[model samples]
Target chain A: MKKSYITAILLVVFLLTGCWDQRLLKDVRLLLGVGIDYQKGNKVIMSSVVTRNLEKKPPELISTTGSTPRDARINLQRKLIYVPDASKNRIVMLSEALARKGSILEVLDVFYRDPRSALNAKIAIVKGKAKDFLETQSKDNPDLTAFLDRQIVTSEAATIVPDVDLQSIRTGILDPGEDIMMPYMGLNKSNVEILGGALFHGQKLTGTLTPGETTVALLLANQKNKQTTLTLPIEKGVQMTVNILQSKRKLTIQPTGQSLKVSIDLQMNAEAIEMPFGDFSDQKTVAKFNHTLSEEINKEADKVIKKLQAANCDVLGIGRQLIAHHSSYWNQIDWNKEYPKINITSSTTINLTRNGILE
Target chain B: MGTRQADKISRLELFFFILQSVIGIGILSLPYTVFSESKTDAWIAVLLAGIAITINMMINWKLSSHFPSANLFDFLPTLLGKYLSKAVSVGYIVYFLAVAYLVLLLFGDIITRWVLPRTPVLAIYFLLVSTSIYLARESLSVITRFCVIVSIFLPVLLILMLVPLNSSHFIYIFPIGQTGLEAIFKGAKETSFSIIGYELLLVIYPFVKGNHTQIRKVILLSSAFLTLFYTFLVFNCVIFFSSEELEQIPEPILYMLKSFSFRVIERIDLLFLSIWIVTVLTTFVNYLFAASIGIKQLFHQNDHRHFTLAAGFLCLLCAEFTGDRFLVQKISDFLAKASFLFVAGIPLLLLLIIYMKKLRWHGR
Candidate 1:
């Protein structure tokens, strides 16, 4: 009984001390956002926002730049009134210029190597200079990092413009025949706006897609959302706003002797939000609107497809589909050499549900 | 009856013991393995494998019912010829030892990479060995009672999965049937590896002190719980990452947990991983116990203490000689393939032999 009592006491002691490596909240500094850029003479510049202002007035933003992200982080440590741990950092912003040079791997090494770095943190590419976008303050939200994360979640836009988190970027860079895309943020005076999508061929930034072009990219990629809206032109002067209610896309790869044929089927349920010059009450007009909308969306989708084919981006992962379905044929043919010349057919079917609150 | 008295365990305790045995080190990598083969349709493979495992479990239980008070050790010789039974028992013992080694390697690798890079590998090995040996030395009832206490944290682990819910990309799992049926079927084989440890039921059958109906309920409930848990985790990884991403990551659950941040806590994966250490310890203890039990059965020893120590020492030696992570992974793959013989093929053959012998006796 005495031995059992002693054993029980020791076990309790061990359980009480639970995690010996536990760190209290007060002992660590929380980094909410990070930005990296290359300066004029072969120097690295980095800026980070610490969340010490969570209690202060309008959340203070501290800006620091150094020759490297690590160096800039050390510099921030020296300048800050309180020490902060960058391990909890949530957002990493890269300048378009720096991204063009393909140095994101270097800037991101700290996050990748550090065990405490959150792998789920959001990653974005800033248009022009990343510093300008990172420095932009929101009027209502005190914490810029939380505000930016919220915007990405709520928008759910259909573009190659995905909110590239750390896990996705890491996987995209590591995997074969797959590339990563990040949300493009541009600074307009004092505010930061999500411009479009930045496409990458491997880790290097290849090109940017405009918002209109991104819609087609998203549709082709089968990433369309329920809230996505499309605009249709019925005639030269008439226009209508259509909200996408449901969308489904299927990619089929057909073997034609020496070559492979790609076919895409797009099905959508849409409703007209505004009928500028057309009578919505007429079934015939609705049918005409549906046909015109289908044609316009298909035409827009074709232009993006042509551009992607020309660039060989494969952001739609059509090449992956071919490899998945027709592995033997895909291996026999050079995707890079044949992708530009392969025949692609885009088919669209649209069903118009209602004509807004007015109709 | 003497054997039954030595190995008796209650039905509820057996349920928790089997649950821990099935869930172990496999949960961490099953998602990656399944996804690498099947792409987005990996969840379907998990469902199929779950059904297959249930069928396997039913066969095993029925075979064990042939001798109500005996286990695999006593019944196998009657089913197969005596020499074949001994050969098969030796094969199973080696498989259990390999399981112990793989668990040690996996546990060591995770600790070195995630928690303590500077700590020497030997120290981690020692800590794990001591904890597992201490648990193995306990009686069957004691082990099950302790496991029941630890199993309470299993639900907590499930709740920790909700953190990834904040960042999941639902579209990542879209166009599910794009990978075709062949790829999905191939992936089901990988899922079967994760569900392999349920065959522990073959050894623990006599320890179960319950009505025949209750025993069936326990096994079915354990299988259902494991299936749901595995499917939930695989879905989490699938939705949390794209098909390409899931293929690249070795430990998707660890990577997914690293993404979460609460106002009070940062780097919750570290905390989550520490909890996972307990799970690993429980699994190692269970495998060690199984291996020791096999030894005792073969040698006809009443006391398992000496055999347990010897097994733990052998596992330690194997872990020490494993050298590097790459070789350890090679050994792991080898064991996964070899386990199919003991886990699937042997049991089916045993059931067939038992059924044929029963028919001949009735005809005579």
Candidate 2:
């Protein structure tokens, strides 16, 4: 009888403390990706894709219109069987129209304010309608999130796109000397491909960066893109592909009176993938080829700098370095106005380690 | 010799008893507070504060040694009259209640803001107070043993602070002495409250199984460790954020971790808060333990356990009175000012008075 009484007490103890926060696995819909697009009359159209299974075929899609992203999600709650959980979100896409307007900090702040919201979710700006990119299917992977994630990872490997998550992007947003540049994704027929990057002056998207220009910016920032390939036109008809095995950059800044003299030193280890017109094995040809490749890299870098200056983009974080190393000079001038007029130059030194199996 | 129950606290338990007593909630906002005044030189402030606390520990050691068998309550009447001693004891009891209440309010606020938004502040306060009372019912030896077990987990806590270095910048600590000496000292003054918990030694000295010299060693060692621990945290925070960015977020350590997440854990700040809530609760337990002992000594009460309930009631009442952050800050400022009398002012004054009385005896 006493043993039964002890058992009863133990059972009561277990029954007394209920799990108030208990969430069942089956009762929640996990949002994988969210696409934000602006409509006429300043309306925001939020489109979300909820992942149902690992097979990735028949997931749920919902689109709702509201003044804010939260409002849009709240509106979407009416149509879902379970609560929409964005904590598992892998990516967020902004339409070119919304990005061009550039006042997207408000839309992005919702993700930051909530502790449960995904801060590391990869963000991309569509070169066209974000809904189109979301609607399009990838031939290789049926899962759009997995497909887009792979594309982003490859782009970062090639140094064609920056490897910044939402948290890293927050630094550029809050920081005055630096600005954010995100991957520019676009729909190519049915497949959404990563084009290049969209440059931003704070939260407002300034302009687009070409694929080649993206490589120049990445190289200038010393962001390692080991597998990056540079294709050059040598002697009119002969084209050569130089696969960069490793790369590094050194940025030097000198404030002279009212102007800033900036020089970028790019050092790279590369291999000639296709040297069809050159001699099989000649030292003189290799010397000339190295000089030619260095000149090509510098030329591309100069063009990228010009475009960056025109857009007033401190994408290389040069302005931040100035603030850190030379605060007096940084305080003397307005970065936005002075950045476009700042004199900048670049020089590249490439050591061609190998010329492929033919060599 | 100490009572057999008092003698149960070993040398290691003695070290952790002081260590756990000192390292409470002060660490949460220590970096931000020091940085606000001294900027990048906040780590210097942490080191200086450690020195000041050690000096206080020396004075406390001198007094406790002067009266070996007696705790602060038993000897205060010998130094001052019975009425004055009673007044001082009541003041300490009130101080402990106020401090515990403040910690309860802070615990409730952090949990509400970061962990459980739906739970009422009263519920959180009740939970903390109830746990502290249950633990406070135990003897000092039992408490020290429990504290030793808790202090063993300090390394794990320190390791969690290191995870945010992946995205941190080392350049923030450069030009380290840019702030003037006055600013750094003023910053040290800002850290007085975080280092306030060491005063528990004045009450628990006889309870510890050690000679006076050994007591000083434990106190100094705890002070040094706390200094290094706080300095390490402050220095890491200074490195984690830019000089200007550190000012924007009040809790640099939490903010730094908020931006970082591991593969298995998303929102590492929440994980940190879960562990940190225990530290906050530890602070609550420390004060309640101190206050109950004060009650037992003052009234010659047979059992101190009853006073734990009374203390918890008073703490709950104080916590409930604090309805908003503005009021809490005001109360915290008042307590920070009042802490000087309890920690340093009274101990040093007692030492001076006793030394003067000794000189008179020698002259006679």
All candidates: TM-score: 0.73, 0.90
Over B30-149, each residue of candidate 1 has an lDDT whose tens digit, in order, gives 899999988888888898888888887887787776777787877777777789888888888888878988888888888878876666676677678767887897777788887788
lDDT: worst 10-residue window of model 2 chain B: B1-10
Candidate 1 Cα deviation (angstroms), residue B242:
6.1
Instruction: List DockQ for all candidates.
Output: 0.19, 0.27
Model 1 achieves a DockQ score of 0.19
Candidate 1's fnat? 0.27
- The runs of at least 3 residues in candidate 2 whose Cα sits more than 4 Å from the true structure, single-residue gaps closed, are A1-18, A40-42, A53-57, A137-142, A225-227, A233-235, A272-281, A355-358, B5-8, B175-186, B242-248
Encode model 2's per-residue lDDT on B129-157: one tens digit a residue: 87678788788887877887776568877
What's the C-alpha lDDT at position B15 in model 1?
87
The number of clashing residue pairs in each candidate reads 1, 1
Cα-lDDT of candidate 1: 0.76
User: Could you tell me the lDDT of residue B338 within candidate 2?
Assistant: 92
Writing each residue's lDDT as its tens digit, candidate 2 over A135-219 gives 6652334455544556777888888898777767766766677777888888776766778888888788888788778877888
